[model samples]
Target chain A: MTAVRCVDLCKTYRQGEVDIKALDHVSIEIKEGGFVCLSAPSGGGKTTLLNAIGGLDKPDSGEVYIAGQRIDNLSKGELAELRLRQIGFVFQAFNLIPVLTARENVEFVMQVQGVPAGERQRLAHAILDEVGLAGLEDRRPADMSGGQQQRVAVARAIVSRPALVLADEPTANLDSKTADELMELFRELNDHHSTTFVIATHDKRVMGYAKRLVRMLDGRIVADIKQDAA
Target chain B: MNLVFRLAWRNLWRHPRRTWLTTAAMMFSNTLLVFMISLQFGMYGLMIDNTLQAFTGHLQIQAPGYKDDQKIRQTVADIVPLAESLRAELPSVSIAARGTAFALVSSEERSYGIAVFGVEPAYEPDVSTIPGLVSEGRFLGDIDAPEIIIGAALARNLRAGLGDELTVLGSGRDGSFAAAVVDIVGIFDSGIADVDRSITEIPLGLFQDVFFMDGSGHQIVINAGSIDGVAELQSKVGSLLPAGQDLVVHDWDALQPGLKQAIKADMSSAFLMYGILVILVAFSVLNTQLMSVLERTHEFGIVMSLGLTPGRLGRLVLLETAIMGALGLVLGAVLGGLVTSWFSVNGFAYPGMEELASKFNLPARFFPQVSPLTLLVGPAVVFLFTLLAAVYPALRLHRLQPVEAMRAV
Candidate 1:
C-alpha cells in the first residue's frame, strides 16, 4: 500500500510582481516500508516536494493523499492531526526545540497526541535507545554533536510510529561517517519497523541507502531509478 | 485539553525575553494603579473626619424656622415644649442648649460686633471641645456664670484679658433692647482663624438676658454616646422631637455639605482617571501577548503541525498571557501592599501644604490611613482586567493557519 501519493502537485510563490513555481505538475508515490531518496541539487524543488508530502505545504492544483485521506481537502486542524498521528518530519536543520531535552523532544509529539505521561516517557526512552542514544536522553539538542542531534531528530520522527517519515536533508550538516551511520539507523527502522522513509537529499551516501531514487531538476522530476529488487 | 495545557505551559518559556518584558510592563501599571487608588481613599477618609470633627459635632438640632430664616422671631423659646420632649426621649450624652445672637461687645476704648454662643458650661464640654481649647484664664463656671470666653483675636482687638469687664448689647426676642455686663474669663484660640476671630462663648443666662429672657435656645447641640453610636442615637433622637415642631437635624455630613461634596467629586474624578489608566495598561498587556505570538509564528506552526489543535494553540497563548499577568499581579500587589501598609502605619505627609492645612484647621502632621479595600481591590481589578485583555490575542491565534505559520520562517 502507498503510504503517500501525490498527483500533479504544484506550489507557487508570488514575489512582488513575479510568480515563482516551486513545484510544477510533480507526481510520485512511495509505498509502505519503502526507502525512497528524492535526490536533487539546489533549487530543484526537493524541499518543496518533501514539504508537500509532509502536510506542511498544500498543493496549489493537485491531489495529495497521505494514508488514504486527501490532505488538500482537510482543515488546518485536521491536517495538523494527520501530521501528528501519521506523518513525521526530520528537517535539514534538525529543528529540535532548543529548550527541550532529546527525550522530551521525542515525547512532545506523543504529548500532543494526548498519550499518558508514563507511556510518553516509556515510548520516548525506547525510541532514544533504538536510535543508540540510551544514556543521552536528558541531553539538549545543543549539548549533542551534529550527528548525535540528527540521530535524536531521527528518533523523534519515528518515535510516534508514524506511517511515513519525510526527512529533508537529515544528514546535510554531518560528515560522511556520521551521515552513513545516520542512514544505517534509517535503514534499520525501515527494515525492522516497516515504516516508510522518504528522504530529500543531495548527498550520494544518503542516495546509496535508498532502494529507489527519484531525481528532480528545475521544479520537475526528470528521472526515476530503481536499484535491486526489494 | 489537558495535553494542550501541558504544551501551553512549556510554550511560555520558549522566549524568556519577550515574556519578561510583558510581565514587567504589567507590573509597572499595576503598581501605579494600586498606589494611586489607595492614596485617594486615604485622603477622602482624612478629609471627611477632619471636616466633621472640626466644627460639626456629629449631629446638630435647630429650632423650627430658625435655620430657614433667622429673622422669623421664632427663637429657641418657641420650642420650649419640644425641648422637654427631646430631653425625655433622646439618650444624649449631653444636650448643650445655646442661644445665638448678633451682639456688640464693647471695651473702654474699642467695640467689635460678634456672634455670641451662649452655653451651659456643664453641658458644653460633653458636646464640644471649646472649653478644652482655652488659651488663657477660664471658661464658664455655671449656668448663671456671667464670665465669657472671648475669641483670641477679639481679646487682642479689645486689649482685654482675664478679669476685664465688657458690655454686650443686642436686641431681645420681643424686639426690645437689652444690656448686660460680662467679664472676660478666658481666651480661646480655635485654630481656625475665622472661628477664633468672631465667636464669643458666653453663659446661657447672660445670653438669655442679652436676648431679653427668651427662656430657650435657638439651637440644641446633642452629643451622642460615641462616634460609633451616632447613627443609632440620631435615629432614636428623631423620635423625641414633637410631631408639630418644624426642626431640622443636621448630621456631620449635612452640617459640612461643602466638604462632603468636594470629597465625593474628587473621589469620582480619581476613580475615572485610574480606570482609564488600567484599561490602557490592559491594552499594553494585549500588545505584549500579540507581539509574542507574532515573534513565534514559525514555532506555533511547528507545534500545530505536530498535531496540536487550533483550540490548544489559542489556549496556549491565553495561558501564557494569564501566567504572565498572574505573575505581574502578584509582584505588583506585593509591592503595592507593602507601600500601603507602610503608609497606613507611618502616615504619608504633604509637608508643603502647611498654610492650606492650617486654613482647614488640620494638624501639622497628615497621616494617610490605608483601608482593607485598598489591599484586596487592586489584585482583583488587575486580574479581571488582564484576563479581559488576553481575549483578543487568544482569538487572533485561532484565526492563524498552520500552513501559513509553518511557512512563516
Candidate 2:
C-alpha cells in the first residue's frame, strides 16, 4: 500500500521580489514499509521535498497525501497530530534536547503524546537497546560519540512506533565508519520491525542502504530505481 | 499536562544560574516590601495604643457649651447635678470631671504661664494616669488643703519642689480678681512636651477659688467598661443625657486627629511602596522568562514538531513560572516574618534629637508589631506578580509555529 504520495508539488522561496523555485512540479509515491532514498546533488530540492512531505513546510501549490489523508488540506494542528501518530524524523543536526539523557530524549516523544510514564520508560529503554545503545542510557548527547548521538536520535524518532521515518542527511556529520554503522542500524530496524524509511540525502553511503532510490535534480525527479534481494 | 509540567521543571533547572537569580530578585523585593509595611503598621499601632491608654483614655465628654468655652469662668451654669446623674446612669464606666483655666504661677523669682486643671483628686485616678506618672512629691490629699501638682518642666521653671509655696492669680467666675498661695505637692512627666511643660493640677476648691468658677467641671473624661462595648455604651449615655444641652461625646479616634492623620499617611505610603515593589518584581520575572523563551525557540519548535501541541507548550511555560513563584514567595514570607518579629521585639530608638522628636510627637522607641496578614501578604503579592509575568511567555509558546520555529536555528 502506498503510504505517501505527492502530485505536482511545488515550493518556492521569496527573497526581495525574486522567487526561487526549490521544488517545482515534483511527484512521487512510496509504498508502506519501503526503504527509499531521495538522492540528489546540492540545491536539487531533496530536502525541500522531505520538508514538504513531513508537514514542516507547505507546498506553494499541489497535493500531498500521507496514510490516505490529504496532508496539504489539513490544518497545522491536524498535521501535528498526524506527525505524532504516524511519522518520525531524524535530522542531520542530531536535534536532541541538550538537557536530556540518551534514554530521556527517546522517551520525550512518547511523553509529548501522553503515554503513561511507566510505558514510555519501558518503550524508550527497549528502543535504545534496539539501536545498540543499551548501556549508555544516562549519557547526554554532548557526552556521546557522533555515531552514538545519531543512534540516540534514531531511537527517539522510532520509539513511538511511527509508521513512517523521515531521515534528512542522517550520516552527514559522521565519520565514514560511524556513518556505515548508523546505516547498518537503520537497515536492522527496517528488516526487523518492517518500518518504512524515507531518506533525503546527497550521501552515496546513505543511498547505498536503500532498497529503492529516486534521483532528483533542479526540483524534479529524473529517475526511479528499484533493487531486488540477492 | 503532567508531562508539560515535568518538561518545564527540567527546563528551569537546565539553566540554574538564570533561574536562581530571577528567583532571588523577586524574593528580595518581596521581603523588603513586607518588612517595611509591617514595621510601619507596628510603629503606628504602638503610638496609638500608648496615646489612647495613657493620655486620652479612649474618649472625652464635656458640658454642651463648655468645650467651646474652656475659660475658668463661663456663663454656663454648674452642672454637678447632671454629672452625678450620669455617674449613676453609667455606674460601671470610668469617668472624671475637671475644670480648666489659664493662670500665672509664681514662685517669688519667676512666673510662668500655665494651664490649671481643677479636679477632685479622689475621682481623677479612674480616668487619666497623671497621678501615676509623678516622679517626685505626692498627689493632692484633700480638697480643703488647696494643693497643686505641676509638671516637671513647670516645676523646674518656677524653681519649686515638693511643699514649695506657689501663688496662682486668675479671674473668678463672678469677675473678681482671685489669688491663692498653694503648695507644689507633685511633679508628673507624661512624655508629651506640651503637656509636661505647661499643665498644673490643683484641688477643685483651689481652682474654683482662684478662677471663682462655678461648681460644675468643664471637661468630662469617660472610659467605657470595655473597649469592645464602647459604641453601645456611648449610645446609652447619649440617650440618658439631656437634649439640646451643650456637650460633646467623642470616641478615641475623634480625640486625636494628629495621631490619626499620621497613621493614615503612613499606611498610604506603605501601600504605594508595596505596589511599586510588586511591579518591579513582576518585570524582573518577565524579563528573565522572556529571555529564556527566546533562547529556547528552536527547542520549542522541535518539541512541537514531535507532537507537543502549542497548548501543551503554553501550559508548560505557565507551570514553570508558577512553580518558581511559589518557591520564591515561600522563602520571602519566612524571611519577612523573622525580620518583622526582630524589629517588633527590639524596637528602634532615636536618642539625639530630643526636641525634634518631641516636636514630631512620635515616641523615642518605635516598636513594630506584626499582623497575621503581614506574613501572608508578601507571598500572595509575589505569586500574583509572577503569574502576570508568565502571560507574555505563555502567549509566545501558544503562537509558536512548529515549522518556522524548527527552522529558527
Candidate 3:
C-alpha cells in the first residue's frame, strides 16, 4: 500500500518582485516500509517537498495522500490531526524543544495525544533506550551535543510508532559516524517495524543508505531509481 | 496534563530576568495600589467620623421639618422618651437628646453669634467629639449645671476662661425673650473652624429651660457604629422610632449632603491615579509576553511540526501567563498586606496633617484599613489585566504557520 503519494505538487516562493518555484509538477509515491531518499542540492526543492508531504506546508496546487487518504484540501486542524496521528517529522535544525529533556521530548506527542502518564513514560523510556539515549533521558536539548540532540529528535518523532517518518536534512549537523549510526537505526525501524521513511538530504553518503533514491533539479524530479536492498 | 505544566513552568525560567521583571512590575503596582487604597479608606474613615462627630452622629431622629427649617420650635416631641426608647431598643448605640438654638454669646468685650447645642453631659461624649476635645478647662457639667463648653477658638475669640460668666440670648420656642447667665466650665478646639468659632454645648436641661422649652429638644442623635454599618443601623433605628410621633430619621449623608459628594469626588480622583498605575503594569506585561512569543518562534514551530496543534501551543502560552499572574498576585498581595498592616499599626501622618486634623478634633495618626477586599481587589485587578495583556501574544501564535515559523531565525 502507498504510504505517501504526491501528484503534481506545485509550490512557489516570492522574494520581493521575483517568484521562485520551489516545487513544480513534482510527483512521487512511496509504498509502506519503503526507505527513500530525496536527493537535491541547495535551491532544488527537497525541503519544500518534504514539508509538503508532512502537511507542514500547503502546496499551491497538489493532492497529498498518506495511506490512500487525500490530504491536500484538508483544513489546518485536520492536517494537524493527520500529522499528529499518522506522520512524524524530524527537522534539520532546532528539532527538539529546548525546555524538554530527551524522555519528555519523546513523550510530548503522546502527551498531546492524551496518553496516560504511565504509558507515555514507559514508551518514552523504551524509545530513548532504542536510540541509545537511555542514560541521557533527562538531558535537555541544550545540554546535549548536536548528534545527541538529533538522536533525541529522531526518538521523539518515531516514539508514537507512526506509519511514516519524514526527515529534512536530519543528519546535516552530525559527524560522519553519527550520521551512519542514525541511518542504520532508520533502516532497522523500516525493516523490523515496517515504518516507511522519506528523508530529504543533499548528502551523498545519506543517499547511499536508501533502498530507493529520487533526485530533483530546480523543483522537478530528474531521476527515480530503485537500488538493491541496503 | 502534568507535562504541559512542566513545559510552561520551565519555559518561564528560560529568561529568568525577563520573567522577574514582568512579574515585578505587576507585584510592585499591586503593592502600591493595595497600600494606597487601604490608606485612602482609612483617612476617609477618619474624615467621615470626625466630620460626622461635629454635630451629626451617624444618624439623627428629628421632627419632620427640623433639618429643613432649624427653627427651635421644630423639635422632636417627647424627645426624652424617644431617646430612652432608642437607647433601650439599640443598646449598642450611643443616643443623646439635643436642643439647638442660634444665640448671642457675649463675654468680656466680644459678642459673637453662636450655634448652641443643649446636650446630656453623660451621653454627649458617646455621640460627639466636642466633649472630648475640650482643650482647656472642661466640658459642660452635669445635665442641670448652669455652665457651657465653648470651643477653644471661641474661647480665644471671646477672651473668656474657666469660671468666666457668659451671657446667652436667643428667641424662645414660643417667640419669647430667652436669656441666661452661665459660667465657662470648659472650652474645646474641635479642629473644625466653624465649630471652633461659632459653637457651644450646655446641658440639655439647662438649654431647654434657658431657651424656654418645657420638655422638647430638637434632635435625638445616635452613633450606632462605623460608617460601613450605617445603612443597616439606620434601618434598625427607624424601626425603633415610635410611630406617628412626627419624628424622622436621617443618616449623616442626608444631614450633611456635601459630605457624600466630597467622598465621591475624592475617590474618583484616587481611582484615576490607581487606574494609570494598573495600565502601565499591563503594558509592561504585554511587552514581556510579546517578546517571549517572538523569541520562541522556532521552538513553537518545532512543537507544532511534531503534531502539537497551534491552538494547544497558544493555550500553553496562556498557561504561562496564568502561572506568572498567579505568582505576582499572591506575592504582591502578601507583601502589600504586610506593609499596610505595619503602617496601620504605626499610623501614617504627613507634616501638616496633624494641624488640619486637630481642627476637626481628629487624631494626628491615619490608620490603613487593611481589610481582605482592600488587599485582594488590587491584586485581582492586576492579575486579570496581566492575563488580558497576554491574550494578544498568546493568540498571535494561532496565526503562526509552522512551516514559516520553522524557517524563522
Highest-TM-score candidate: 3
Task: Report lDDT (Cα) of residue B19, candidate 3.
Answer: 95
DockQ of each candidate's interface versus the true one?
0.40, 0.44, 0.75
Report the lDDT of model 3 for residue B196.
81
The 10-residue segment of model 1 chain B with minimum total lDDT is B72-81
CAPRI-style quality class for the chain A–B interface of candidate 3: medium
User: What local lDDT score does residue B124 receive in model 2, on the 0 to 100 scale?
Assistant: 77
- Write the residue-wise lDDT of candidate 2 on B132-190 in tens digits: 88889888778657788989888778888888899998777777887889988899987
- Candidate 1 local lDDT, B249-303, one digit each (tens): 7676666677878877887888788788778778877887777778788777767
Which candidate leads in DockQ? 3
lDDT of 2: 0.80
Q: Report how far residue B224 has shifted in candidate 2, in Å.
A: 9.2
User: Which candidate do you rate higher for DockQ, 1 or 2?
Assistant: 2
How well does each candidate reproduce the native contacts, as fnat? 0.64, 0.55, 0.72
What is the C-alpha lDDT profile of model 2 across A86-130, one tens digit per residue?
899998888888878898888878877879999988998888888
- TM-score of candidate 2 on Cα atoms, chains taken together: 0.77
Task: Give the lDDT ranking, best first.
Answer: 3, 2, 1
